[model samples]
Target: MNRNLTSQQKNAVLLSMAQLIAAEKAVIIKANKIDVESYRGEDIAMYDRLKVDEEKIEGMILSLQQLIADVDPVGKDLFHFTHENGLKITNKSAPFGTVLIIYESRPDVTVEAAGIAFKSGNKILLKGGKESLNSNLKIVNLWHKALIENNISTNWVEYLNYNRAKIQVFLENPTQKVDLIVPRGGEKLIAFVKQHATCPVIVSGRGNNFIYVDIEANLNLALKVILNAKTAKISACNAVDKVIINSNLIAKETFIKKLINKLLKFNVEILGDVELSAFENVSSFDSDEIWFKEFLDYKIVIGTVNSSEEAIAKINKYGGGHSAVIITKNDKTANTFMESVDSAAVYQNASTRFTDGGEFGLGGELAISTDKLHHRGPMGLQHLVTNKWYIYGDGQIR
Candidate 1:
């Protein structure tokens, strides 16, 4: 539905949704409580993401309001030129037609993700998991209300409640035209979508993120960053799942011991590579497959690297290509690590947690794309568009 909406019309829908969310906060929370109550999973991360409290509702409203203040993502000129035959040609931003977002356990995605697609002038179809079915339904109803209030087509926002089998069928033969598909969930869910979907699928939501503590890293800073990255929000895709330490760092054992003590407070399970086998409360990775796993739980792996080269190679081999951080005081080391590490976002002396769209100053994100095509990192409003070429000719022939 790239029907050429004026900027005012788009912002109106977002503002209306914000107001609707504010007015329906209690009802929304009530519905979310049902979802939370029905959730019987053992995964703490999934449980955490399933809950929608008052603060989370406020955050949803804030995301919509923030999106309303952003400029229109479409129709901006990327390039313009006069052809040799005197034809005026212009290349400008355009919508991706319809965007289908498949997510699990997050009702706010029903708001923020849909808002980005609508504001970009693309229709959005939401496929939320059964865990958040009640919550997602309520929020999508609010979306329909906002569209009606703005005199827009309610079809612009649709909620698809399909089982895994149904979803697989739909992906293979979508009932409607699907320009882009974004699967925002764990590795299994992403793999499911990529395996079945015929359309272009942007890989999002997996994070086997890493933080390398260089030999020159300040122990205090490394501890602080690692703790925040690993425990601040265990469910986030940007959360740190691995910590690689420089083998020759001063007092390396002491640092690991201190790190273990801090992590114990959060009750995080620590796994170590063969080099780190001696630490207490730290177990060895049962298999090499653990290196490729994105542990969305209170679990982490700590490995030792002899040099930055080893760390880079290790990360490139097993990392999710989502986010990687290097903690060091050396500028040259930071630069080389940042450039050589193949992640969507590279950090120096900062937590991997800041890979988020809001933190990166893009306002809000639809998803954190690990794929290199079209976009990478947090997919905000500006990244939701494609480009089209327009030409005006006056009887010109080659």
Candidate 2:
């Protein structure tokens, strides 16, 4: 079990962590190189996903510094009111005490989680995926050094050095002293955590994001948004996985041809339904399984919907509860889709790729949460803090 640190101590530790991240850029780059070299000759996708360069290292440091400078989320008063009986009540931020974050290959999550936990005044215990163990170890070591340098209890940022068996024990042990369990990875990992974890689990599920183009949408704008959303970075959670086009717009052959040409330019494989088979440029796929799949590559699934209502229903049925974007000039259609889709984040005339905490200017995020309870959408510093009510009253008692 890790020792709990006071808010003051946590803040000092965060400052030191930020400074260390900034000063040891070269060291971070070197550690990343070691991981990359070790991962060579493995699956190309896995290697690319695990490799970190100098640019990413600098970005991580900048994100840490930004988080350290941001206003602390804890201790902020959320609400305060006085009753007619003269009883005063106040709802303010409070830490969850100890947070257990189980994440995968993304080594950047170490700093992001640390910053959020530090700002929200909670002790963190991190267990990252085995693939990025070396990179994660380097990051954890730097943070531990920072905690020691700031005279804070290093246990506040505990790193689990155990194997899969120990992780299973940690998850299943009812006596484990974890206030909250945050699982950041694929559906399988999230499912495992949700099933076995005795603590309150926040499952950040896979993001099979979607974008809908209605009849009222501007073709040019839709094309631009779709291209960027799918091609910006396919491996990211926010990237577009499926695109639903209104059948009315699909009848416009010239527009469809132009769009297909543009998509093919980037080697983006298209899997469309029978209705879209007329477009000879793209490939086709059957059933809704394609919509549920997150390619995490240069691939996209396309479908045709009869109306905006149908599009909304399709997204709700197939989406992985991540993000959905509606591209429409009609305010009613856009607003209706936004309200109807039961996803974590919904956008109007914007790419689903923008459904990220970093894009929302929160420095960086712990994960893109698909769960509706506890935490949803982007898990950032604000989400790290919970609220508690403080009452101050005179002699009047309820």
Candidate 3:
């Protein structure tokens, strides 16, 4: 809990961390395999998260390298001006000083957050989930080794090694040593942090994305987008959880039939209205509950909308404010949907699955935030830093 590192020492620690990850790629993969084997008999959700093979390790390495290549987010002047009274004001980026990141399941977040904090010049304390404890420990050990190699204080990247009680103590530690608390986990974890922690909390809430297929949308394009969005990976936060189609298009039956065939082939269950009941593959469900649900699976809830306004209303009412997409050929319709829908990331002619930090070209994201305040959408290195003002004057006191 000590903040003793100078800015120069912090940067050096991060540089060495990047070098270590690149050099010891095989070590990371080996550690991940230990976790994967331990969770072999667990549920699918836990197993998928615990399993990290060579591909995932490669992705982590590439993301870390990209972060290393990007310009340092700290120390840039955002604004500068001088008043007539000779008061000089300059707003510039500065580290949050110390950050505490509490996340779950995803071992990759360890590397992602560490790299960003290193580049932005902040000391970080990480508390990863127990499910992936083995993987997290391995990664954190390498980071500490890197710090020693570069002659930097290992305190810059401290990992909380205790259990739940210790985590709670760290969050409510009131020492105020931790400036920001970022929780990248489920709703319960985020809610507990938000309600209990005195430190500023960045809530990266769960994602419930939606996609609307307008009447003017080409049938072929809609099918491709829907398939890619839902079937790509149902477990991800950005995957399509709900789909709304224009009533007019449903009457045509051509698009609905094609969509149903593809979805069934992938074992995706469809819950739709009476209008869609004619499709043999779909099952009818009450419209109310389905609209508000975020099915983090291959199951999708379908609703028929009267117009673009209705589609927007449904999305606003049901969405988790993470990501929403509209498929349409009309520019005016697409623009209207984009402006009216209130979400962190809105898309046109694309799948909601593309709402990732790497896809947006920020190397990778710490998390996809549903919170509108402070950090929104895909968070990168810049989001980890805050701004401070520096004032200079020649003995001119107001």
Candidate 4:
């Protein structure tokens, strides 16, 4: 394994990667074009994430630049203590050794997530989906170029070009050391990794995120937030999937009608709970299982709740544990909902789409983790490091 590269060395490689990506923009785009054209899947979201343009290339370069500017995550002092026996001990941040990240069609992960992991001092093993193979290989080649230019070992960034069966075999019996595994995709992939991997897995789980429209909410504001959260980028994990409207909301019928009309403008298919089925355009769902689904498409579910507590209960019961929001003018109600909702990110009067690493001021993220242990929310360079205890003793015995 390539271990203990200095912060300067890592930053130099990242800077070189940014320069290379910028210089080879056309090449990268050409590669992504092949992946996009070859993708036979009907998943619009995956297709959207697979295709790369000049803007996405710029985003990749920007991610590298931002990661270069961020603080080094390794070697920071977390805690210190001294014993009376002249023994000193300190806990400091350290890399997780080799981190295996298994993800789906998003090609940007090849650059952004790898940059975060590399900057945090961990050797990364990226296993991107086959749908984006061409694009991923192009990016990985650039990573190799950057590493070689810096005289750093290319082992720092390795790509596992394996299929599902091969990946399962690798997970069950890794050829190299793997300290942590992060699965970033739909539930099936996360479940598959969890079921097979021997190492500890950090789940970058689904996002059946919800929004509650409180009785005191500004309907106009709620409408705008819902529209953006649900329609702005349906492919995003932070996109809102379910909406819980307080049954007693003023002009509830009028608001629902307006929301339905607005959503229909974007060609969104609206699903409704039992109470909401009365609305003309809203289709009623037969199974409660729909609440647990993360629809990465132009679809949304609208339900009704009696109170803030009820809304909180439903969100906790059915949400993806990713993000939930409450639209309200009441501080007490907002605080209650924010504190009560069990999710990585909770919002009040804002769009759930803001639940992102860069949007939350973390430059870029390795993954938007829903796991409570190790870390939650956006796993940035700072969040990627583990801790190690260092002890100093001059002929002192325990």
Each model's TM-score? 0.98, 0.92, 0.93, 0.99
> Where does model 1 exceed 4 Å of error?
none
**Candidate 4 weakest ten by summed lDDT:** 1-10
User: Higher TM-score: candidate 1 or 3?
Assistant: 1
Instruction: Pick the TM-score winner.
Output: 4
Ranking according to TM-score, highest score first: 4, 1, 3, 2
Residue 4 lDDT, candidate 1, scale 0-100: 80
Q: lDDT of each model, Cα atoms only?
A: 0.93, 0.81, 0.81, 0.93
Worst 10 residues of 1 by lDDT: 1-10
Q: How well is each residue in 1-398 modelled by candidate 2, as lDDT tens digits? A: 33445556666776677778778877776777777777644444456567777767776777777776677787789998999988889999888888999877777888888778877788888998777888889889988898788776677787886677888887888345889989987777888888888878877788888899889888899899999998887778788988888888844677777778888999988888886766786777666577788777888887788998898888888899999999989998888888999999999999888888888887788777788888888888888878999988789855
Give the better candidate number (1 or 4) by lDDT.
4
Predicted model with the maximum lDDT: 4
* RMSD list, candidates in order: 1.1, 2.4, 2.4, 0.8
* Candidate 2, superposed: residue stretches over 4 Å from native: 1-11, 40-46, 83-87, 174-176, 393-398
Q: Relative to the unseen true structure, what is the C-alpha lDDT of residue 381 in candidate 4, on a scale of 0 to 100? A: 84
TM-score of 4: 0.99
Evaluated against the true structure, the overall lDDT of model 2 is 0.81
